[model samples]
Every structure is written in C-alpha cells, then in structure tokens.
Target: MKFQRIGEHGAERPIVVDGEIAYDLAPLTGDIDGDFLASGGIEATALALARKRLSPITIEGLRVGAPIARPQAVWCVGLNYAAHAKESGAPLPDAPVLFFKTPNTVIGPFDDVLIPRGSAKTDWEVELAVVIGRRARYLDSVDEAMDHIAGYTISNDVSERAFQLEQSGGQWSKGKCCETFNPLGPALVPRDELDPGNLRLRSFVNGESRQDSSTADLIFDVAYVVWHLSQYAVLEPGDVVNTGTPEGVALSGRFPYLRAGDVVELEIEGIGSIRQTCRNAG
Candidate 1:
C-alpha cells in the first residue's frame, strides 16, 4: 500500500489512500509512527487504515509535505554500489562506509536544492532511502534485519566534493551537509510494494539523462546493509538510511561540477520520482 502527507497550500495533513478510498488520517492520529512500524508508523497502521475508509479530503486541495515530518536521523552509505565506487575513485570498503547528514537537511519533494556558496563541486546521487520501523539492536541475521524496515523513499544525496575532500579533514559530512541538499518524498511506499533487488534507478539533469542503473548493481543489498549497520549502532524508529547511489554523478563525471540553474530528476521503478531545481546560494 502507498501513503502520503497531503493538504491544501498552507495546511498539510496525512491521508491514507488505498485505491480510491482516501481516509482523513489526521482526524484519527498524528504522525505515522508510534511504538511499532505500522501501529503509528508509515508501514502498517496507516496502510491498514487506508484500505478500510474513505473520509476523503480534497485530493489536490492541500500541499504535500515530507512523508515523515522530522526524521530521527538521516544516515548514508558511501560507495555501496560497485559502479558508484569506481566512479568516485574510492575502493569499496569491506564494511559499509557510513556518514551522517543532520535531519535538518531533509526537505519535501520538488523543493529547490541550494548550491551552498563556495561549493565548487556540487554533485548529485540518486539513492533509495530505507525508513526504519522497529527499534533494533544487535540484529542476529539479515532476514531478521529486513523485518525492521518500515518502507522506502527516493532521496537525492546532493554533495559538495571540495568540502568533502579538500577543506574538511576528509570528512564525508563536509561535502554532504549543504542546506537543501536532501530532497525526500513524493510519497513513502511500503517495502512489500517494491521488490528492492529489481527496481530501476535513473537520474536526469535539465531533462538530459546522466545516471542510469538498477538496485541489482548494489554490491551490498538492503538487507545485508541493515544487518551490518546494526552490529554497532542501535537502529531507532524514523532513522533513514540512504542505501547509496549508482554511477554518473557529477563528481565522477568527466565534467565540471554543477554551477546553478540545473534541475535534477530521479525515478525509481515504483517508489515515485523526485525532481529538484538547483540555484546558487548567492
């Protein structure tokens, strides 16, 4: 089942839409998560509610907001895809390469991605974001790990290569934490609705195709990634993990980085598409 946060221009609310029956979720509850993944989260409770009722609000009347209002944390994996690793000129780490992008970077779909000032190397990475449902710790197996996921969404891991490598002690966050860099949600689709291994991911700039690939190319798939990350950190509700991107980002291209006025669009087979316009900070 698919769900989204909806509303008119100024007021945004959540609604459960299963087929044609749209339920006014805001009248019943607050956010999508609570104790478990679905009971109060994006995965089940809302979906279960969506399939049953039709307390419809104007479908196109309100504005849409990020599926998850304020994510607990936005985590990212670098070089998880073989082609991406090669393009970025980094050797694939034996273990997942992790980084942090403060949750503040999270923004709604279609918002403009600001190219931070002095950012001479802004890059784009179209990644599949995994939303956690249950709080997990020391997960025993990949199968068990997979069970902890709530759903998925499309994310653009907008980056600034110069900050990452040259100015900031080689910290990934330096290049990754530019404001308006992370554009999330047209909507968050349940994991059951999407077969992760088979989905196709594509990115375009100003209508020109740049990155094109499949999750099938991920050297480390979703399940293993969750299982692996859990060994060290406690995975909490609303924590978002950006599974990583395929090749063809500007940093890895045979060209100068993004300047300004470039628009990026990313599509995943069933997860919906995300379009972001780039504007200079000046």
Candidate 2:
C-alpha cells in the first residue's frame, strides 16, 4: 500500500491512496496521517484498511508532500556500489560504510535542488531509501533488520564532491549536507508490498539519463546495512537510510556536474520517481 500526505486549503492531511489521493479515508482511517502511519505499523494496518474501503481522494487534486512527515534523520551510505566505488577511486570496504546528512536536508519529491554557493562539483546520486518503522537496537540478524523497515522511497543523493573530498578531513558530511541535498517521496510503499531485490534505478539530468542500475548491485545489501547500523545507533521509525546509489554519479563518471538550470530525476522500479530542478543558492 502507498501512504501519502496531501494539502487541503494550505493545511496538510494524511492520506491512503487506493487509486487517487483525494477520495478521502476520514471515514475509514479517522485522522489524516500522523495517526494512520503512526497507528499500528503502516504496512499491515494500511493494507488491512484498504481491503474494506477505498479512499475517496483523487491523485490529481491533492498536493503531495513527503510521504513520511519530519523524519528523524537522513542517513546515507557512500561508495557501496562496486562500480561506483571503482569510478571514484575508492577501495571496497570490508563492512557497510556509513555517513549522515541532517534531516533538515530533506525536501519534497518534486522540490528544487539548490547548488550551494561556491559549489563546483555538484552531482547527483540516485538511491534507494529505506524508512525505518520501529525503534531498534542490536538487531541480531539480517532477517531482524528487514523487519524494522516501514517502506521505501526514491532519493536524489545530490552531492558536492568538492566539499566532500577537498575540505573535509574527517567525513563526507561537508559535501553532503547542503540545503537541498535529499529529495524524498512521491509515494512510500510498504516494504511487504514490493520486492527490493531487483528494481531498475535510473537518474537523468536535463532530460538525459545518467545513473542507471538496480538494487542487485549494492556491495552490502539492505538487511546487513540495517543490522550493522543498529549496533551503533538505535534506528527509529521514520528515519531514512539511503542504501546508496549505483554508478554514473558525476564523481564517478565523466565528471558531469549540475549547473544553475539543470533538472535532475531519480526513479526506482515499483517505488516511484522523484525530480528536482537545479538553481543557484543565493
């Protein structure tokens, strides 16, 4: 099932999309979003509710917002794809590599991506994002990790390779935490509703395809990454984990970079696509 949030008269409401978003589920789910999603674990309850009543909302009338409201963190993995690792001249890591960007970096699906001041290596990374569903720590195995996932969304891991590689001595956070780095949502499909093994992940800049691949290429798959991160920090429901992007990022490819007017998009099979227009940060 796809869970979403929409705006009505400048106010936002949670919605369950059966066919369209505006058919209204107030009769079925009671409240807009915070409840339904935070209610009984969105995956199970949403599917169960849709079985009895279809939503009255039409997908067109409502303005879509990020599927998960106010995520706690927007975490990411770098160079997790073998080819991407090779292109960037990075060695294959022995374990799941991790880094983080502030949740403040999160923006809506179709929002604009800003090129930070003095940024010359602004690039794009099309990634598969996992949204956590419960507060978890010390997960024992990969299976236990998968159980913590609430849903999936497409993310544009917009990066500034200069800030990431040049100025930072410690971590990649400098290049990654620009104002509009994380573009999330369109739809958040519950984990059980889709298969993660094979999804055609693709990215395009200014109408030309750039990054294109599938989840099958990750050096460390989703389950292990989650389980590993759990040992360090507790995973909370609604926190986003960018499972990492496949190859074709500017940092890895022929050094293509975004300009003031470039349009960027990332899509994954089944989940959905997200787009952002590029503009100079004033």
lDDT of 2 by residue, 1-282 (tens): 577667742355666666443445455454333334445646544555657554465557556667777777887888888999898898998988889999888877887889999999999998889888766699988789888887788888888988998998978999999998988887788888878777889999888878888898888888888899999998877788999888887886585799898988788988878888999999
* Candidate 2 global TM-score: 0.91
Which structure among the candidates has the greatest TM-score? 1
Error of 1 at 22 (Å): 4.3
lDDT of 2: 0.79
lDDT of each: 0.80, 0.79
Task: Write the residue-wise lDDT of candidate 1 on 1-282 in tens digits.
Answer: 566777542355766666665566765556554243545555445555646544665676455666766677888988988977898788987988999998888877787889998778898889989998777789989999878888888999998988988887857798888888888877778777788887899999888888889999888899998888899898887788999999888877665577688889999988789898889886
Badly placed stretches (over 4 Å) of model 1 are 7-11, 20-22, 33-51
* Inter-residue clash pairs, candidate 1: 7-62, 7-63, 8-61, 8-62, 8-63, 32-40, 32-41, 33-40, 33-41, 38-45
RMSD of 2: 2.5
Clashes of 1: 10
